[model samples]
Target: MKIGLYFGTFNPIHVGHLTIANHLAEHSDLDQVWFIVTPQSPFKKKSTLLDDHQRLEMVYRATKDYVKLRPSDIEFGLKQPNYTIDTLTYLFEKFPEHEFALIMGEDNLKSFHKWKNYELILENHSIYVYPRLSKGNVETQFSNHPKIFNISAPIMELSSTFIRKEIKAGRNVRPMLSDNVWHYIDEMNFYR
Candidate 1:
């Protein structure tokens, strides 16, 4: 089975995220897209992030209605920083019957070189890259390797940071996030 592994902190799963996953499911060769919730990443600043379990719960609530998108906590058992290479390796060993592809954004493309065993990641897993609004006009900016891909995905101006800021400011985030996720956030008093 072809699985698209979408790795993220998913502080609060948003509509933009669901749109990309849905697009990948509909357009790509993959049979399923797993939203792999990272506990933490060395590259990210953790102060602004929600609790890992809460984030994962939000992802689950957001995606529970979608059959094609699966929420995973694989990184919960893995090492800190949650590198893609290690997760892929563990998945391969655990489920030899399945194959996974990485789903990433163009901005992250620049950080590709910083990942652990990046070449090995390229050699083993396929990456489905969606264009980022900030990647500029330069195409294939991180094309040192042939495995890097470019695909057309809806680039929404929205972001988790923006949504969080809105929530902090007592602004309605209903239009930005899924109803289920938004309700959960309110019920739990998240981002306060």
Candidate 2:
């Protein structure tokens, strides 16, 4: 199977995330897109992040209806300060029969070289990059590489940070989240 791993903290899965995943599943060569929920990212501050299980549950609630998209807790069992290279290596070893790729925004490609073993990732797997509205033009040295594909997926200016801020301010975020997720957030009083 050809699986595209869409890795993110997913503090709360929003419609923007769903739209990108759905677009990738429908437009790309990938058979499935797995939203690999990261418990913690080495590059991000943890103070603003929700609990790992809460984020994971929100991802599950948002993506449960899509057959082509799956919510993955693969990083939950792995060590904290998870690195993409280590996760990819582990996945390759565990699922030798399946082919894996990475799905990311063009903004990530701008700093791709900063990632650990980035060259190895490019050599072993493909990357499907979608545009992000806030990101400027990507000027990567690896632009010509065959494994890197630039896809024209819809760009949403929305972000999880904005959603969280809205919730904390007692503003409605219904349009930004799935119905299930919105209800859950309200019932659980999340981000408030």
lDDT score, candidate 2, position 71: 93
- What's the CA RMSD for each of the models? 1.6, 1.0
- In model 1, residue pairs whose N, Cα or C atoms come closer than 3 Å (at least 3 residues apart or on different chains), thus clashing, are none
Mind giving the per-residue lDDT tens digits that candidate 2 earns over 1-192?
A: 999999999978899999999999999888999999998899889888888888889999998999999999999889888899999999999999989999998888888999999999999999999987664556779788899999999997789999999999999999999999999889999999
lDDT of each: 0.87, 0.91
What is candidate 1's lDDT per residue for 1-192, written digit by digit as tens? 999999998887899999999999988888999999988888788887898899999999999998999999999989787778889999999999999899998878777878889889988888988877783555454675566667788886678988888999999989999999999999999987
TM-score of each: 0.94, 0.97
Question: Candidate 2 — what's its lDDT?
Answer: 0.91
Best by TM-score: 2
